[model samples]
Target: MVEGAWLWLTLFAIGSTTILTRGSFVLGGEGARLPPALQRALRYAPAAALSALIMPDLLLDAGAFDPANPKLVAGIVVALAAVRSRNPWLPFFAGMGVLLVLRKGLGW
Candidate 1:
């Protein structure tokens, strides 16, 4: 485990980096405008980030591709539900319901 001066130095470096990056936009003010292409691309960042975080869990089981994985099945179900339903909550709940039923109720 990290200890002593090295740990404190590491934490300070991390904290400083976070503050500088996050504060850059605010400090730059109205003149600091992103390019139009960049602005458009940023719109997909949230979805990309979400998929980056979730796709692995859904597609991989025990570090191998598993077509029969319950999470994979639930993810497909949720994607369909999101496309069909206008209500956001419906997909969220549907995904959770399918996951729970598969993982717990049906013992997948």
Candidate 2:
């Protein structure tokens, strides 16, 4: 429905806002230092973001919580493998292997 100069203007506004907000730190240089507490909190942002993206898929099935889901089991396996093994790839491969085995080999 939106096709004309208005759409171009809206898109340009959005793009400019995004660039300014995302590049604020770089543009401000050392004067824009974050507080110490905020800096420390940012350290967990990646893990929190990843959990936000993955937890729903792992815990839900057909719009309901599923404790017996194979993905949940695989996630548990991944957590355990990560804790026990030093290699990062081991947990990923182990989780995928468990998932494949459960979904394909055992038909869970």
Candidate 3:
């Protein structure tokens, strides 16, 4: 069992960290602006995050990459849909649809 003081200290630390981290944005009013370089760099954050989230799933299989994996093909379809549609959620649905069709209909 955790010691009472240690548990309380841990909870306090977590609460303080959460408040301080989130409070910065709240305290910075609507008109407050980040530096231009920071703003420009931040623009790639979503793309970077999406790649980080997706690349592993598309590329990896049983600890190795398989070029012929249906997931990779579905991912390609999703990428094309994203480029053509220029919409974020549409790519997700397109990927899901392709994955379903490949897995269920074509039995990939």
lDDT string, candidate 3, 47-76, tens digits: 999899989889988879777888999999
Rank by TM-score, highest first. 2, 1, 3
TM-score of each: 0.63, 0.67, 0.57
lDDT (C-alpha, whole model) for all candidates? 0.90, 0.93, 0.87
Q: Please write out the lDDT profile of model 2 over residues 1-108, one tens digit for every residue.
A: 877999999899999988897888977796767899988998999899999999999999998988889999999999999899999799999999999999999999
Q: Given candidate 3, what's the lDDT at residue 25?
A: 73
In model 2, the Cα lDDT at residue 25 comes to 93
Q: Model 1, 1-108: lDDT tens per residue?
A: 988999999999999988897787887786887799988998999899998999889888998987788898889989999899999799889999999999999998
The regions of model 2 sitting more than 4 angstroms off are 1-23
lDDT for 83 in candidate 3 is: 83
Best by lDDT: 2
Between the candidate structures 1 and 2, which one is better when assessed by lDDT? 2
**TM-score for model 3?**
0.57
Misplaced by over 4 Å in model 1 are 1-23
Instruction: Tell me the lDDT of candidate 1.
Output: 0.90
